[model samples]
Target: MTDAILRMRGITKTFPGVNALADVDLTVRRGEIHAICGENGAGKSTLMKVLSGVYPHGSYEGEIHFGGEPCRFTGIHDSERHGIVIIHQELALCPQLSIAENIFLGNERAGRGGGADASGRARHGRGRGGLGRLLPGLRLVDWNRTNHEAARLLERVGLPENPVTPIADLGVGKQQLVEIAKALSKRVRLLILDEPTAALNDEDSAHLLDLVRGLRDEGITSLIISHKLNEVLAIADSVSILRDGRMIETLDPSAGTVTEDRIIAGMVGRDLEHRFPPHEPRIGEEVLRIEDWTVHSPARHDRAVVSGAALRLRRGEIVGLAGLMGAGRTELAMSVFGRSYGTGISGRLYKDGKPIEARSVREAIRHGIAYATEDRKRYGLNLIEDVKRNVSAAGLDRLARRGWVNGHEEYRVAEEYRTGLNVKAPSVLSETGKLSGGNQQKVVLAKWIFTDPDVLILDEPTRGIDVGAKYEIYSIINRLADEGKAILLISSELPELLGMCDRIYTMAAGRITAEVPRAEATQERLMSHMTKEQEQVG
Candidate 1:
């Protein structure tokens, strides 16, 4: 008999003015790593939310079967009772809490009493012996046991961090490991990870995939939603394609039928001939140059975050920065952009053979430089505002007359960008927060592009976006470069760097380690330079 751990039959989910999912069916075998691939807004995350009880039992029409028993989960806690845990793309850990505290935050173990008096149990909001069975001791948390268990879980996830470390102090990769460890603590049977490796680098992503493989070997089932096709192909036993809120097909990679091209065809509903737009940069004189740039840490005065980082970008040239996480690429970019990030920043920025003063964001914009921040939701856009406001946010002066915003001009600018970037929205009046990842990124680009900058810095431009959206963004980048705008691109994906950049610079330990021309750059060579500092330390 075929072993099936979970099944969803004829699932139909709908939201206002949108049918997100329609009569979709999915089955995951026991102890297997199943991958879900789709274009952005294809209902991947929505489906996972339904499976994990985020949408509740009666909200969506579907039959969800787990372990041969139909499940009607009313809430997340209900799903957790059945050993189903979901780690979302946006992490849910409290930054101020320590690792142990965050892991056992809601599910804490009790002390040595084993059971408590009726009055004691009532005081702690527990039924008859609820505290005794769940915690062993009533109203008393066991820190020793908590730390010991937390340490073990961390070790299993291959994270080298103390249990007492604050979540805010940890990097994005380590935070992801902690999320997995939290899931492990819950006796998870079917773990759902949505874009777990989206924020991670090559080494960290590799380690996470290894952990997933080990879990599969240990008979734990995983359902991963990812945009990185290579990772999905590498780790998943079976791959399911989703397009426009419908199931396309599921392929077994071991049967030699699964390829990136085939998957792209399924996702886009077309055989995409090329993953990237052909880059034929028309080289020109140097447009932007930085000399001996250095920035100190914001938290620590003595620590240097970026030191002696120097680079140059010419008109119509797209230059890429490749490095591991925490390699200071983002920091360098932010520091240069009006010192928006680090403290004690010392950098000499030259534009078109002349030194420019960009001590603040206003001056930076005035100097014809624009920065599309990495954390778009946090820094790039006002989520509560409409698309019209967000598009003119960076260049409000252009839409103002006599210290007053010209409403018609603002709408005109936003509509031009909205239509120009092909952002899928009802109108310029639509809320920016309501758009999907790909559309949101396009809006961010529209905001910066509206500023009419001569030089643009894009940080992780395609992060958390689907393949189709990535191709669109790449086309926009190529278009901008062709227009003689100097572009500085930073990306975690090596293939993206190799495909889009004319020259690639490698960063390690806050310094530029090597600069490779496009003709000589490869993944292996870039990675070698990226980890040189760690190798030297070892």
Candidate 2:
């Protein structure tokens, strides 16, 4: 028998009108970190889903050998039985549940059975249907044992949270650790992490990476699906490049110094000379300005989410908002747009030197302003709907004749953007849920663009997109700026803001600490301002 712990041969999966995976092969040694890299629509997630039995045995053509045994897993539970567990990009944790409960939600520990059942089980351990004596109905949860085991698993993943604490209280980074703990609960041998650190900050990402390395030392085989190439080159012992639903090639980074440029070439099938499209900014007159903006949290009306913030946007200019995850960048944008968030909002909005009120989302759109949400799937687009509906979501009135909508016009408008934005979908009729993260972002851009807004507020526009798709988005932003739209770009990545914005503002503790021109902004300088201590002001 070979030393490999897992081998997938001739894996092919197809969707309606889409061949998601075709003849893909992957081999993982007993203990190694293997990374899968590709563009957004590539078969990275699809391949992992096949292995974890999300596609199941009969749905795809593949032969999977695990731990020297030919395996046929019919469901996620079956794969878990074989020690395969996959943590998806969007985490599957219930916010209301405690860490321990979430970890063992499906797989629970039970107390001793009833006297009758116990006696029967003692007589015949395998009961009537050959199912175990511990029936779910008679299974009372052993909370003390559950919490104790959960703590052990949490320690293994380096999470220091109380197992009984609600998952909602933890940050995204900590929540990820809880997910790993949940995987360890299953005694997982083959762990698959999809975009593990996509939502993490630099510190948290480093911590997560270190934890993964620790897991490898413990003899666990990990397969990571990520668009971040630098991460792939850093940790992956073997790197597999997938493109257009076919296996291109696999390389060993440990053999030599494998550059990010090389990985990009394999992913996009071309030398991506520039991360951002070249642009010369043409900043015109001020189009939108905010004065003394303050917003209180809707839940707790006394707590201020944004305070005394002032900002300005000029036509043909792209201004970047630089802040950490909870630095009120989004709060400020949403409040200023239409007071969409928070209570007790006190703000002065100006358009072309005239004071204006945009107290609602509809009024904001009517005022020629648009805001693309940070969480696109949650607040931006209707995922179940088709491309045409999502594309023309914000500007339905443009396609509407009085009270009725013109479906043909909506399709025409969506098609125009689909071609212009280069969105990779089967057609305008295709469900938005089926589109990749990058393409879905384009559709969100199309929705806002269709509104013909003079001011565009983009929140983390390229959050989970690959480098190639990021370049395309940058080009789109530049084009929009060139078309004389005042753009406010909000991003967590300092480099993205530096590369794309003409002017950048750093926020700390619900306040704008500093404004740096493009000529002066650097990661270090931005970080200094972003980390500045805020005054205890309301």
Candidate 3:
């Protein structure tokens, strides 16, 4: 008997102007955590899509063998029937559905029984619309059995949420567990996670990795696609590297050869001597300062999202706001940037020691202030629009002539930033959505940078991009600071802040708890200050 549970030979996949995968060969031994590592657009996700039948059988040239049996999966359902399930990073859960309903969704089990919900109508698996919209072969869900099975699966994944809990109520980490629980409900044999923990905080990431380990121990094989090389090094039994749509090499960490450095060398074809570019800040007079800034929640009228937040940014200085999730970092930044978020806002803003008021986004831009949102997909860029439109969106007035936008000037400005930022796209006409995460991030930066802002507030500037892309973004930030632009950087990654910021401020319970200089900062100290309110209350 052979130990291999999965084997794909000569997998060649192509898109309209792109060869996603080229004669790639991948093998997986039974009960092992195999990681796939690559930079953005290296075809890692495309390869997984092929294996999981997102590209279908006739769409790609490949031979797949699972459990020594030749497989021809035509769609996601076909792969699922054979115990292969993939969970994408964005998550497919419907926020309004209950845990049990989402777990049993699509893979619905029918019964010859009445399943009337609270309104006395036939419960249709908590799907939108009505009961008539159930999946084609599935009718009449047995709610009792569904809830029981969901509870059992939840226990297996170590999620203690009630089966009836709405998916929106749980955090991203718990939502991930529910996804795995759904996979287990299908009796999954080979599980694939595509950038599973990219959105999760550190504690949640640790829990998810531990759960993957536990699942591996139970004889389940896992394939993880991640940009986080450190996490891959910690959990992967074997790692496969992909570059330029070709298989480079697979390394076994058990033999002590697979390291972050080794993996980076393979992914980018160079030794990344430094993850962050060194910088010497040219500190100058205070560019912007906020005194007694407080913002109440819009939904909850009485709740103070940002309470008495006081911070200052100096010319050519990068200041970091470090906090745990919901600690008011984003809220503070948004409210200060012309009340983009929060309500009942009270603040005093000064620029270059002169008082200024920006009551709207337009006014903020007029005052030479720009806010780059963390959720780039949602608020930053119009994904359907091309690069030129997004780049000139914030500062359209500059290209406007007699109430009409000069397309020629807009294109010129966008092309300049595109070349300067090294945005890897065909041209300024490519749709923003089609580009990779790193390039999309550059577009977001280009949008704000076009405004020619003197103060830039970048929230989670490098959240989901690869390390190489992150280095590029860091260099951009350094260049901005060198140009005498005061930056307020907000990030959850402590190492990133410690490396890039000249000073870091800790916030907890919506209040600025401590301001620590980079020379005196450590992760432990930052964490302690971040949880100060919780510690005091407990």
Candidate 4:
């Protein structure tokens, strides 16, 4: 028997005008946690999709060897049948279903001969035409048995005891644990996790990493794909780097040579002297100010998402709101921007020196405020629309003459922003959905920039984008600040906050707990504020 449990040789995949993967090779040892690191568009997800049968057999050129046997997977079900399961970057559970139901969705057991396996056999045995042959069949599903099995799987993945709980009630971290439990329920041998901790807080991320280590000890091999270098350094046994669809190199993490800087250099193909550009703080007059901003949740409960939050932004300054998930950073931004989210919002806004009221999104735009959402796909861009339409969506009123849009004017504006932002697409007529994640984010930025807002609220601006693209975004942000635009940047990455913002406000439990200037901000200090627990109200 071979030492390696999984191997891919000469893998190559292509899309229209793009080579997603080129002659890539990978080998996974038995019971080891291997990591794949790359920037966005670096072919990590594409390679995993091929392994998990999302690309299937004939679509890509590659040979997959599992347990020393050559295998061809036709679909995800084919891979799952052979104990090779992949958990995607996005969790794939039905929000309304219970944990037990989701875990045994396709693999259910029936009494005697009537469950999923039995139904298949019964259907095949119908041709035999014997009542006695099917007489012993039982079709009733036992809830007790299903719950027992699901509980075991959940325990293995370190989830709390709640098999009957709906997935929607859980946080992203716990929901990720449910995904791991679902994978383990299939008795998987080779498990793949793509950006497992991307949205998780530090404590939750550490717990998930510990679970991965435990899985390795129990003889389950793993392949992890992530951009966070620190987590890679902590959990990986060996690491592989990919650049522009080609395998750069694989290094042993234990060899004392695979530093975070080394891996970054390999991914980007250059030494980064400074991840953030230098800024000259010529912060001018106050551009935006909010006082006693409070927004209630849309749910029945009168929970305040943004509780008495107040802040100010100066022209030519980038201020960051640093917080863990659910800390109301995005909520505060959205609520202030034309009451787009939340209700019972009461806030006083001042533009320049005079007080103004923004009752709707259009009103907010009229007052020179623009908000770029974290979820660019859902809230920012119309995926079916072309680049020209998306860029001019915000300022369509200005582009119209006698209630009719001027196509020439629209195209001219889009062309100018596309060129300025360096958006890489075939043409402005290309569908927004067809672009890469990085470029899609750029289009969102372009749309908001077209609004010509005096104050811009960017929520997680670089989320899900690649390192190279993130650098471009960072540069763009600095240029905006240099051009005297006040930016409120909200991000989970401490380094990014420190690198770009002149001042950082640390939020915890829907309140700003601490404020730190750029010169005094450190990862340790910022994290201290982020994790500080709020006192329970009586």
lDDT of 3 by residue, 1-538 (tens): 1399999999999889889899999999999999999999898999999999988999999899998899999999999999999999999999998898899898765654446432234555534445535554445677767777888999999999788888989999999999999999999999999999988888899999999999999999999999888899999999999999999999999898677889999999899898789999999999899988989999998999888788899999999999988899999998888889999999799988999998899999999999999999999999999999999999999999899999899999999999999998889999999999999999999999999999999999998898889999999999999999999999988989999999998999899988899999999999999988632210
Q: What are the models' TM-scores?
A: 0.93, 0.91, 0.94, 0.92
* TM value for model 3: 0.94
What value does the lDDT take at residue 43 in candidate 4? Answer: 93
> Which candidate wins on TM-score?
3
Cα misplacement distance, residue 314 of candidate 2 (Å): 0.8
Sorted by lDDT, highest first, which candidate order results? 3, 1, 2, 4
Q: Candidate 3 regions off by >4 Å?
A: 115-139, 534-538
Q: Worst lDDT window (10 residues) for model 4? A: 118-127
Best by lDDT: 3
Which is superior by TM-score, 3 or 4? 3
lDDT per residue as tens, model 1, 1-538: 1599999999999999889999999999999999999998899988998999999989999799999999999999999989999999999999988898888879886554333221122123233464545754445665666778888999999988888888999988889999999999999999999999998888789889999999998899999999999988999999999999999999899887789899889999998888998878898999989988889999998999788888999999999998888899999998888888898888688999999878888989988899998889999889989999999999989988899999998999899998899999999999999999899999999999999999999999999998899999999999999999999999999999999999998889898888899999999999999988532210
Clashes of 2: 0
In candidate 4, clashing pairs total 2
Better of 1 and 3 by lDDT: 3
1-538: candidate 2 lDDT, tens digit per residue: 1379998999999988889999998888888998999998788888888888888899999899999898888889999998999999899999988898899989986644222121122222233322334553444556666778888998888888788888988999999999998998899999999999999877789899999999999999899988777788889999989999989999989889678898989999999888789999888999999888989998889888788988899999999998876789999999987889888999799998899999999999999999999899999999999999999888988988887889888889999999999999989999998888889999999999999999999999999998888998999999999999999999988889999999998888888888899999999999988888554222
